[model samples]
Target: MTALQAATRETFWTIGPVGKAAFYWLAAVAVLAFGYGVYARFAAYARGREDPRDRLSNLPGRVVSATRTVLSNENQFDGDLYAGVMHTFVLWGFLVLLVATTILGIDIDVYRPLAGESFWVGDFYLVYQFAVDAFGLLFVVGVGMAMFRRYRERDGRLWGKHTSLEDDAFVWTLFLLGVGGFVLQAIGIVGQPARADEAVSFVGMAMAAGFEAAGLTTAGAEAIYGVVWWSHSLLAFAFIAWIPYAKPFHMISSFANVVARDETAGARLPNVPADLDHTNAESLDDFTWKELMDGDACTKCGRCTDACPADTVGRNLDPRDVILDLKAYRESVVDDPVAGRRDSGVATDGGVDGSATVSDGGTVPIVADEGGVIASESMESCMSCMACMDACPVDIEHLTSFTRMNRQLVDEGAVDSNLQDVFQDVMTKGNTFGESQSKRGDWADDLEFEVDDARETEVEYLWYVGDYPSFDDRNKKVARSLARLFEEADVEFGILFDDEKNDGNDVRRIGEEFLYLELAGHHVETFADCEFETIVCTDPHSYNTMRNEYPEVDFAEFADDPMMPFDREEPWNADGETDVLHWTQVVEELVDDGRLGLSGNELDYTVTYHDPCHLGRYNDEYEAPRELIRATGADLHEMPRSRSDSFCCGGGGGGLWAEHDEEVKPSEERLREALEDTDAGDGIEKFVVACPMCTTMFEDGRKTGGFEEDVEIVDVAELLIEAMEAGS
Candidate 1:
């Protein structure tokens, strides 16, 4: 056979035994560093307090789901398509190369020595070499994309407040390393006899021809090949070692975070333990293990910051910074103990038990308004909208730690005068508006039929008429319209009348923990007096807390008190069951079941619907209200950022009471989004809202922004009533 027909191969340890020995020594160090880095992260987690939520149940399923989520880049794509594409190429290409490297190691170390034959040969060799080059091409392209996007374009989305030289180093090194692999392959072929078989490795073969044309003799090629091989090997090992040290640290942390993520994270925020002393996270030490680890997983892609309504509107809150600051603080205490300070890690029974945490350092406050690692003002600026969590690619529980800091602010009495007033009103008057409890049912006074008190009647739907609907004059009209509409539908629903207090949804979000308990606990007590199958409310805030967070409260404590209106067998939330729902969900179900009849299309105005953060992002109830809108015979022109991606109205988490310096309020920003994003030719004449807070914010926005003539703010109930009247 001629030289052209010979097989193509690179023998193992071509530079001799000394070079091979040196490579092994370096590989050992890199592997050791990587192992220790991983260990330190997990060991440090033993400092945090245990989250009571069982994140490990159905462990296999979680692993599979997380694997799918990462592989598919499911959550990443929806927020920024360009970033998502970049991630996809990087992740898949990297995986392919990683597997190829592992196989090469086995072929050399295990098969050749023991079996006396290289397994990477013949048809298998051809296919394997071709696959490596094919996938390596993708890895090269992805790295180039990353480098150009980060350095050339200086894309603001990739550069958060924590942009560092590490990011630059990471991208440049990875790009060089990726391109270097192909170059090394070309060198391998040119340094040997020409081969027909190597043609299957198309990219490598093509490059080898170029190297031959460049006057590279066999001896010259061999010299260049040794240097290139060592360079690639050292760089590859270095990259692996750097995986847990630099920006690429997300590679490990992100996968672990995703695996441990709770599907109901923000919707059902973690319950504050009754016996815990670190109620206010004075430091990184006060956070739960998972909460503390959340920071280490941040990709800093800026999706959370970009999607943040507060950040978008120029409010002080930056979700990415919040995580990074906390992360930096955690890293600062690495020398204090294996566990930093708090003994909260859930690992027990030989897992990294946090109970064994050695307390060697004093406590430090983390959320000071003036100069803390995480400023209280940023926490206050949070709307509890969950937009950050929704947009996070790694499923970082930003709301969990964000709201915990808010609680600390509340503990320190650092809240602004406006929030302070609302807290006072809730404590003294049993509601935010400070209206008399006797006046709660006054909105239904002019209704065609007397609304049955849940206290005096058994009902299918115990409508929790919230503080705004029960007392605020504007929402009272909506309350009345809903009442009349329910009557028309012949729905079996009743209200608590003067008996109910605020459910403390916003109060809980604002960091008034005990006050929220007082309110939510009292409402649970009030519910014991009534017989109802389901709890429904027009206030999505009330609905959210009751459905998700209320399970944390043990209403059985009140069951023993003599002053309690009724006897109870178990704690109200002991079973973790409460069929809490928003009124739109109920009405939509009614409409589907043919219980609530709607009129034909008489109110066919081009319209847009505003999703309440509580109902849409937190509770996942986007479809019910939209279904109701379609039933109203209106031309439903949904805003571009509608459904799960809907913008907040800025009235939540005490934003209704507090103030900010943004150029436009979140509500006003949302109004502009609806007007500009809706595709109605005649212009959107109506903005329909499902939550009372949304109604208040958008209506105020419409008036304040001089868009009252452009679009009218109306509740879904009012639109239904309009269609109901037309049917009549």
Candidate 2:
């Protein structure tokens, strides 16, 4: 080799071993840091004592769906966006920095033998330097924005206390640590000048000129580099160890939780398990670990709390807090097995007293103490509206957990006396009214058509005349109108009549899962024996339970029962069941089929439609009812919160039976919105409803709000039936 080449080789050889040792040490530190992070994560999973299968099932799909949802612009919540942007940037920056650090460790330690000798080494070094500088800047900026948002945003301030001082300090400390590391590395690059033609680290090159101008000597620059690198390494290590104990732990835990989330649409209710016998199992004594883990998946987004009418009107409940309680309770169970053991009667090391005042119904009514994680009021105040489940981004079935707890209390006769009477009525007569089965067919009297058999005969459609439609005087008109519409269209339909049992949808929603299953089981059996092709019910609760909940029945032999099709894709109608019409749909179908006609001149008054929570949000059947109304050409007005965002009528989830302490009733609030829309220059004087529950709530609201004198409420089906008669 030439003299110059030999000298260059010697120069490289001299710097190589020192660089190799530095990288090796960095690699060792990184491996230890990563190892600690993994261990901590696994320890948390173990601590939570969750079912592994629950986490594993549908996880990949959930992750994919959440990613798509985040990226999409559809129906974005403004508050969520503000929070998401701050979180996403910080998360991405952290990821990039993490990767760069890992590579830096490997380059310094494992690949030091090849460094300075290979062309690839220079290229990789430049890339690593660029990545670190870019992500570090992003991290600093993102953290700054988050700090500002926490301290300055009006909404954030209004929501209560912002970020704690300790969290702010930790964030700023992290930012400074990252910045200092980069600055030191940049200074070191400036001290040791690379050839102009060589692959240069952009950040390193920029800093080199600054350092040269500042007149820092090579020895001084190296010393600064060593200090900064050491600080960065130590801080990184500390972050790994601190993750599990800090709020930042959500960074990892949230991702895991999101990935393992359920994949159903937010509006659909979860399936009620049919394993426990509602008739015999007196209390919540039958709950399994799977039932408990169902509660652990909550993300605590507060959407449920925001959506809850009870919370809005100053009720003591917060659905988000309820789910949090379940999580805390599950964690307590894990920490102290004795706390969950039925036979145990002493406090465990985990501080949970086994001898807490548990009701005969299996309800643990312990006061909020250091050892007890849940309170009685926390469980009782739930309205069972399924609002929490709807609002949950992860689709955690909060209502089911609440129902399980209620089942424990109700079965053991531990609930309030008023509720006990309702349960007894349900048990005795297969209906909440405690009326005889023979009385169920009373509404069918005076009708011009024959009531075909719902159970013993084959029919295109089996009209499941729900209890309210069958027994309630006001709702009977709705049933009669629906029957007339079907007859006009020549639709081959029959009624279950006295044979049809209560579907108990509200019972389940109100947390009477055991009673709900008993009712559901009988209904399922009745459907099977009747051999009905399609069961059409006006009640959304019945539709939801039959379609969604019954499938979870544990009996494998009954899994594919004709009543509950495994694949929900099959139509719930006869050969031409073009629509499983809400009575509104049937009326609309009759109009569309030319069997029924509406006279444009019959109804001169303007009308508005109140979208029921179930028909609108749960079933997505908003258009048919509105179309039926518009077919009459009545002036149609809409409330501000209509369609999927419609407020509940305050009668859902057995709210009709439970007398609420009238602070600001949900129905009154919804009615006020409707009243406001009526005066919106449309001159609407009537509010058209499709659900019986909505009708009941609005009528009550009308009386309470003193709007009965000026406005009127009518069923959507009744309007179409009226229009048909006008034309006839």
User: Which predicted model would earn the best lDDT?
Assistant: 1
Instruction: Give residue 499's lDDT in candidate 2 (0 to 100).
Output: 63
RMSD, every candidate, angstroms: 4.9, 7.0
Q: For every model shown, what is its TM-score relative to the native structure?
A: 0.93, 0.76
Candidate 2 local lDDT, residue 282: 22
For each candidate, the alpha-carbon lDDT, in order, equals: 0.80, 0.60
**Candidate 2 lDDT, tens digit per residue, 403-443?**
55555555555655566677778877877777898898888
Off by over 4 Å in 2: 1-79, 102-142, 153-230, 265-300, 329-337, 347-372, 446-451, 555-595, 598-610, 616-622, 634-642, 676-684, 709-711, 725-728
Worst 10 residues of 2 by lDDT: 4-13
Task: Give the per-residue lDDT of model 1 (tens digit) for 414-450.
Answer: 9888899988987778788988888889999888798
